[model samples]
Target: MKNIARTLASLLALALTHAPSALAQASCSSDGTPQPVAIFERFISADCEACWSDAATPAPSATAGAAVLDWIVPGKAGDDAPLSAAATSDALARLQTLGRKPPVATDVHTAAIEATMPARLRVAHGMPFNDYLGTAIAFTPVQRAAQRTGAAPAAMDFYLLLVESVPAGTEGTKVARNMVRNMLHGTLDKRNKLSKSEQMKWMETRSMRIPEGAQAERLRMVGWVQDAQGRVIAAAQSTCR
Candidate 1:
């Protein structure tokens, strides 16, 4: 099993390029140069046993990913969050090039996320709520099945919550959704053995929601995922006022 996993990881490594440094992360929306969302990272050291305790590669690592960058995005605020295709594409492309462990340890870096974050962002999870200074997009989870019949999920489900309402004239809500979440969960390639990047990617993939044209005032949504039997997986929450 170990040999197979290593082989696969090597194969993946061969296909990937060196990851861009955290500095490569963008500071603004494509059109809006001002609106910036804060970035918190927790890259675990190679010697950190806590980092790998969760699994072969460890999803919820006990070791912390380093909190690297936090910058505010400057921009004009509109009511609804703008969905950017370019931003999404760039994010996906970056994920395809993972060469090493990122300075991100999921929940472990949330505290830094809130303190350093310039704008309100619905963080993925693990940071305390009181520390959050700005708007956040939190949500609960819902479940879906695989296209294959009798195909058990290779791994657990991922979820995001939209408890916080993103109102009009906010600094950078759209940037938060696109950059922060995608940065966390966009790299999701799976081999027999898993890595932290793959797990985070899975989380981002399944978790998210909008209240179906609901006005953005004190609005809240839950992003979560469940099993075939409707059992809860994991969830996060963020809201707007």
Candidate 2:
């Protein structure tokens, strides 16, 4: 019996060593991420102290199926700015992408995720480790969308966001926020059809750095896919366990 137990343990260890990477890490909860029908983005400058605590700052809808994101654009004050530590260049790029100038204090934008879009986007992340988090996003084309004959491959832009959920009162703010801390971007061309008539999908897995002072437990991920026209096709937000 001792020898049998030893053999079983050895087998188990060997199996684990060869396990798939996905199996080695946790994904979203069993219920999966939120399927947000609309995305709301709030922009604030790190140098603006009043903006952080202002009650007029726009907020995401309380209605279900909506996702809100907060971006801290780097202020002209540079590192000396109050919230400079949380400011990111990605925010600036996003402003450019949206054709919006940086606001002196705060601004808001909204985009809808078409419920009838033919593609699906899923985002997930594993538990944080070593100041890094494993995150992934996948794009899947429905049967008809994938089987379009002789159609040009569609251009797709993928965005994965790592956000810190801050309570309304935590930072003297009157509203809760999903603060964007880190981001990953990629582009893909949709396949005209599934490979060998099987599943055709685009996916990317990456390690996102956890910013200093970010509470890992409060971290979550949001992702969306945009077409060439910059319309959101699908959006998802992770639910951390």
RMSD of each: 21.3, 7.8
Candidate 1's displacement at residue 51, Å, is: 49
lDDT tens digits, residue span 98-200, model 1? 2332233322232212221112112322111222211112211112222222333434333222333333234332221112322222211243223453232
Candidate 2 stretches greater than 4 Å from native: 1-25, 29-31, 61-63, 148-153, 190-199
Worst 10 residues of 2 by lDDT: 11-20
- Which 10 successive residues of model 1 have the least lDDT summed? 26-35
Residue range 1-241, candidate 2, lDDT tens digits: 5445444433432332223243444545213455788889999999997898887787667766778999999999999998898899999999999999988999899998864457666666666566777676666767686577434347788888999999988876787879999988878664422255444567666667788989998998898888888888888887745
Q: Once model 1 is optimally superposed onto the true structure by TM-score, how far is the C-alpha of residue 44 displaced, in angstroms?
A: 46
Candidate 2, overall lDDT? 0.75
lDDT (C-alpha, whole model) for all candidates: 0.26, 0.75
TM-score of each: 0.21, 0.82
